[model samples]
Target: MQSSVEAIFAPQPAPEGYAEHIGTGLTLRRSASRANAQQVHQLRPHVVEMAAQYDRLTMPVEIIHGDADTIVPMHIHAEELIKDIPNGALTRLPGMGHMPQHTAPQAVVDAIDRAAARAGLR
Candidate 1:
């Protein structure tokens, strides 16, 4: 858990205009504080348990993930998740990153629409 926290807070070069868009300086201060690690540790078990039950989900599941995401690699996270879910559908956005809603809003909306249609909610 300590290693996980360290990786998350590990310094990386800022992407272009990142600070400008968020209107603040990117700092590793919060990561160094280790407050988030405790919260994650508490929630990790619950998250793992829920993930294990993905095969039992009856509702439509729409998974939209960026193919270019390094933080949560497509194969390791979304791809693996879809394999476990009976009704899971993955929408892989080419050349996109972790934040698909911000990077590919239309694709995200379309995926949501498809999920709703599958669930008869739209």
Candidate 2:
């Protein structure tokens, strides 16, 4: 069973037999380099502090989130974001997971259109 954190961040399963293809020397080196890249954990506090001031934003904010997203739960991220921002709106897509931009591009575009329209930018 996946831990709650893993479930939330990596809800989708890797493609079958993907591990078997990672043995190439180039792949291993690339993977290792990426793993060693800069860590952003130290910035969590700063990010949270900035997010807390959402209501101060004057521009329209649109949150496009999948209802089935597990990595960042809709309630904890999208819903709360909408509630916190003065001009925020949420476009909740049912049966979609976290990567809505990849999984449902048209919906994401529609959400963008809606946001633009709401902001009178269309």
Candidate 3:
């Protein structure tokens, strides 16, 4: 992550107008908030179909989420992903925000190591 971008999301004292976009040259294009809402709107039937596909594939899976993240709600993504898989687990990190690799590298590495153990990769 860029220093300026990370600095923008850092915890800080409450300030008026502080939440305004902080950078000009940054370019990020993920599915829009509008698209996310649409996807969530279509969740139920989508999940049923997705679960069927997952069951057919029979793939092992794991999900990692930062509990304090606001940008992408962990419960919304990781919880659903875990629910979709037969033998999947979701790990939620306490006190970490948006990106654990940036906010808590050691914890992220530890999670990876544990995942590796689960996959017999270690």
Candidate 4:
């Protein structure tokens, strides 16, 4: 029996398979999907309500912001999120654009290690 699916609609191969287990470096250009602003607009209310509920107002958190980020605008979201978080420390990385995981993998790893240590995740 012939399937109804067309050849063009077949699933594409995953470039990096689970067996590879590549290092935690990011590939945002290939990974990130640019969504329409309108799509995000519809979810704003739900997002804000969720944020208010899980603000982490009493937890010790470290926030690192890329000053040159255009996707997640430092002046808008990250800064405000940091402000709302109690005992939050913000690290502003100058000349670092969006997607620090790709541009500064070491820094991201270091931050995670530090956070883990602080949280006693040894």
Candidate 5:
């Protein structure tokens, strides 16, 4: 389990707090009671169909993705999102991994702030 989680961080060392959080989340997702885990994993297949409704999304979206992330495929989530959404902005962090909010909290914050401005919320 540690090795699998380690791969998600890759070249970067996982910060202790974030690592623990991620590990706990992973444990929960894999537990027998987490029935919705499959539903979350299965969402990728519906992105194209769901994206057809992107025009109705009346708010801004900010996708902060790591180029090096191996957990969730970038093509399925971030790339597809930034391409399909009219008001979507992407911050692609090179050499970063899955946990951008931890490794680059400021970048995440900046993205949120940008999204807020775009949505007229800031």
Candidate 6:
């Protein structure tokens, strides 16, 4: 969907499929949704509790992760998640670290856009 709210000044224009969250910080990322750090704070408590539900999700999931992610090992997190999620897929960034969105913004956008299209969002 096109952004109903037009963007003005930003650290950089949020790339396609991404939105800039300028509230707590001018952070930008396309997480398959418009959730920013502030919004995440509210859901933090429930995230761990919801992990078990990933396997039960029927929605298509696209995981764009880094092969070198030490913080959350790709094999452990992304690989395992893709296996669990019924309609899930994964794209790995060869040399990237933990933050694929920051290290490979365009790639992240492309992956998210594909996922959104599959989910009928774009």
- Model 3: colliding residue pairs: none
Name the lDDT of candidate 3. 0.63
Instruction: Show model 2 residue runs off by greater than 4 Å.
Output: 1-38
- Candidate 6 TM-score, true structure as reference: 0.58
Q: Report the lDDT tens digits of candidate 3 across residue range 1-122.
A: 35545544443222343335433333333545567678789888976776678745444465677777677787777877777677676778876667666566787677778767777788
Best by TM-score: 5
Model 5 C-alpha RMSD vs. true structure (Å) is: 3.1
lDDT of 3 at 15: 33
Model 3 deviation from the true structure expressed as Cα RMSD, one decimal place:
6.9
lDDT (Cα atoms) of all candidates against the true structure: 0.74, 0.71, 0.63, 0.60, 0.78, 0.67
Q: Each model's TM-score, in the order given?
A: 0.73, 0.68, 0.56, 0.60, 0.76, 0.58
lDDT of 6 by residue, 37-94 (tens): 5586788668767877878898878898777666677888788778878888899888
lDDT of 2 at 2: 27
Q: How displaced is residue 23 in candidate 5, in Å? A: 5.9
Per-residue CA lDDT of candidate 5, range 36-109, in tens? 77778888769668878986776888888888888876776899778777777788899888888778899988
Candidate 4 residue pairs that clash: none
What TM-score does candidate 4 get on C-alpha atoms?
0.60
Model 2, residue pairs in steric clash: 8-70, 8-71, 9-71
lDDT of 1 by residue, 6-119 (tens): 333233334455546654433346764476677767997998999888899999999998777777888998989999999989988887766666556799889889999999
lDDT of 6 at 110: 92
Candidate 3 residue runs with Cα over 4 Å from true position: 1-52, 56-60
Regions more than 4 Å wrong, model 5: 17-37, 40-49
In order, how many clashes per candidate?
Answer: 0, 3, 0, 0, 0, 0
lDDT tens digits by residue: candidate 4, 22-116: 43233224443244445666788887886886456655577777787655678897788876776667778777766566556787877777777
